[model samples]
Target: MSTDAHPTPEGAQSGRGRAPDTEWRSWHARRLETITAPYGPLSLTGTHWLDDHPDGRIPAVPGVWVQDGEEIVLTAAAADGLTHDGELLSGSVRLTAHHGPIPESPLAHGDRRLVVLRREGLRAVRDFDPHAAARSAFQGIEATPYDPRWALPGRFRPYPEQLSVRVRSADGRERGLGLSGEVVFAYDGAERTLRAVVEGDGSLGIVFADATSGDTSYRFRFLRPFAPAADGTVTVDLNRALLPPCAFAGHFICPFPPPGNTLGFAVPAGERRLIGG
Candidate 1:
């Protein structure tokens, strides 16, 4: 989908009418179920990078993990109590980073899944346990009551080509953020635009902040719009804005908003923070 040269205004009571309060409530309830799930972000306990431990011993985790080219070599003893696919593992095995759901990870230490992850060129292992402290202490997600005014019609304008910008991440590290286009919409009588990245599923992922950030809400939030129509028409719904994964757990390395993605106005909608935390 590509944006047209001229912006198009969608009627307030057109095909995409205001969503009912019950629908928004249901969405919020589902969000809670997802985040508090057993292997969700809240269950993550550690992100152990191999480079940080040259001795091949990960802190607090049994077994030795060493980076071997594009794969990782894990050496364990029977006493380590590590298993692979429910079988006890007492030797060495090579493993590649997992690309699917966390429950599908191969290595497990009791109830914890040792998930391999590769970011940029660095390799790391994430430990996820259902009984993690964060998961246990999770009260709920703080969000504003849904309002129709926060939902606006928008158009997606693709760039001539893809572009990558280096931005600071929540972990205090810099990483590349690939941008494919911008989503433009009218708000408060003015047109606004946000640089967005095309997700693997063809949706648009946006990380943004507003005047309410760091005050009434989190420092930044994320929004993912469905694939645009052939005419680049889409709904820019601020009421569905979400807190990044880092907001649920400190171990997650979520990226921050790219340059110019921060808005000058306040957006009092969507998720604010983890309740009581």
Candidate 2:
């Protein structure tokens, strides 16, 4: 069967390959809206460190926040309209920077939510407001129509063990990039493979580019294939290639593709670039 006929399961449609003409255009329109959403990466105004405020009070955030051991203590009043653990919490509550999804976050103060964060040994708070200017300016994501030619079957070859390599960040910082293995696949009669990292949820995230990158699209695009099977085989579908967080939020520390991840041919499919520059 063709990749477009990959079959849509019961609840969710198959996210692989190109959508039919009607659905394909609709998906492209929605993609633009998602990338340009209010809380999207572009609107990040500040990332405040708790250490910066010795007194534990962040400016513009209506609460008294202090670090207590591994948790952060937030003190607010009923008038502050803060909610925590499903209750309109007043006084104080201890919180840890949530490692889970943003929708389930427990700490909120009216339109603003205090998101605890940790990087290295440093602790900080992320403030999310629905009224953020970025959210308002969002139009939508720019993506190319899904094409089966970009979808290809691939095999996963594991290394001896997990390997960590250092790469320079867009922010001029060096960080560790971990690799589990390489995903080898064929596209346009050419065999190609890319080094990828396995997400905690078992998805495969690859940073790559083709001859079209830097000219047709951004310097690089991201591809997230579903988790591999027990035998270590997965689909390296370029149809669903994506843009990195750095493309949205400047504060994000995104890793660059290693030397070998770049494909020599132009793979002109999926999200090409954002609109309006």
Candidate 3:
């Protein structure tokens, strides 16, 4: 089994002095728990698009899911053993896009969730089973100890107008990824910048790749710097950088980093790769 001492970054300064080791360790533990939880990323087995199956019959998924205007109509039979809200559903239910967590999905067969979703006017259903092989085979995530050099002060420079760029998703389809602005910081004694996406909570989300990408680390990683202060100052803590959802599940359609988001230098800190088969 691969193991890291999980040492704390003693001098990871962000104008808040040293980064708290215990807090980071606790966050790491919770992250592990969240990813391996039932119906989490590892449990996602398939994402079947409704358009791909004109007959509304998806393999291994018991139900007829068809797009009717902006809503999805899911017709289920009692024989399918489908339930909604803890009650057996024997008829149809109008389901719109699911914007919440997977566990709260509207339809289920025993412990498996049939999550209906829509993206860019396309509809689909994701089947998440706790007994998925990926979940059972997951061992651990290889990560490097935190280092202060990766956690630096950065400035968010918002664009005069928000922009959307089409990028290739992990599923090899093109999708629009909205960009709010850019975050600039110093690395290798030179100014480095990355385009930022404003998350639902107004925090700045950075999708980036580095020299270590495709080798030591995953193809890409994510860093979320909280909403800037009054002066547009935010801490770019790569120590807390996260592996993308696609890293854990093949069904996820994680987008590639926007143009110029790849750093030129190697960043040896943060999550690297999956540990076991």
Candidate 4:
């Protein structure tokens, strides 16, 4: 944690202020609760792709899942103990990729949610169970305390058109990383930038690596700056850097850092790794 308050540049202090330590601690607690929730990432036990299992029978999950055009056709017997909307499913139900939260998923087996997920035209089913070993052996996250130096003023420069770059995911599969803009800021007396994606809620999402990566922190972390002002000014707060979902579960396919998103300087703030086990 840095105690020195570096001078906040003019015009940058207008709508942004360093968050109090209490607030950051509260946020961290909430994050822990979210990730450990019943249907959170940590509860994901398996992701079975329909294409990979041509037999339609998924391991552990008691259903025959087959891709039927854009939707997934799930056939279940009463003995399978599968339910949809609290009623035991006796026949079949056509399921499309759930665009909502895991708990809202229509398919359930006891307390587990069988969520249909689609990635690049490939469909899959994710089994989330509250009793997953990863959730049971739960540990807290390790993070550095709030540091004002990691909070810098930045400007968003949107590209004339959206662009994408090929990057490898945590699953070792290459995928396209879409970029909507670049966030330019000053760090360590030098100008630096990161390619950013505009999230659905209009926030800026960035996946980056810093000098501390793979040493004191995870190999990569995520940063989400609030939407930029009309003048393109935004606060780049690295103190809120986050571990990608893959850090919590291997089933998640989180994208790796794209080109030029790796910083040369060490950032000792934000979430590092899971504590305990």
Q: What are the candidates' C-alpha RMSDs?
A: 6.0, 6.0, 5.7, 6.5
Residue 256 in model 1: shift from native, Å?
0.5
TM-score-best of 1 and 2: 1
- Residue 121 error, candidate 4, Å: 0.5
- State model 2's lDDT: 0.68
- List the candidate 2 regions with Cα displacement exceeding 4 Å: 1-44, 51-55, 75-82, 86-90, 187-190
Clashing pairs in 2: 31-141, 32-140, 32-141, 33-140, 36-138, 38-135
What would the per-residue lDDT of candidate 3 be over residues 92-207, giving only the tens digit for each residue? 98888776677888778999998876778899888899999998899988887767677789999999988988888889998888888999999878999999876655677777
> Which 10 successive residues of model 4 have the least lDDT summed?
1-10
Weakest 10 consecutive residues of candidate 1 by summed lDDT: 2-11
Candidate 1: residue pairs that collide: none
Write down the TM-score of every candidate: 0.92, 0.76, 0.91, 0.92
Candidate 3 deviates by what RMSD? 5.7
Error of 1 at 155 (Å): 0.6
CA-lDDT, candidates in order: 0.81, 0.68, 0.78, 0.81
TM-score of 4: 0.92
Estimate, for each residue in 1-277, the C-alpha lDDT of model 1 and write its tens digit. 1111000111011223445566677777777876888988788899989999999999878999999999999999999999998889899999898866778898999999998888788899999999999988999989999898988899999999999888887778887788899999999899999998776556788889999999889999888777788999988888878887788888877777889999999999988877887
The alpha-carbon root-mean-square deviation between model 1 and the true structure, to one decimal in Å, is: 6.0
Better of 3 and 4 by lDDT: 4
Show model 3 residue runs off by greater than 4 Å.
Answer: 1-18
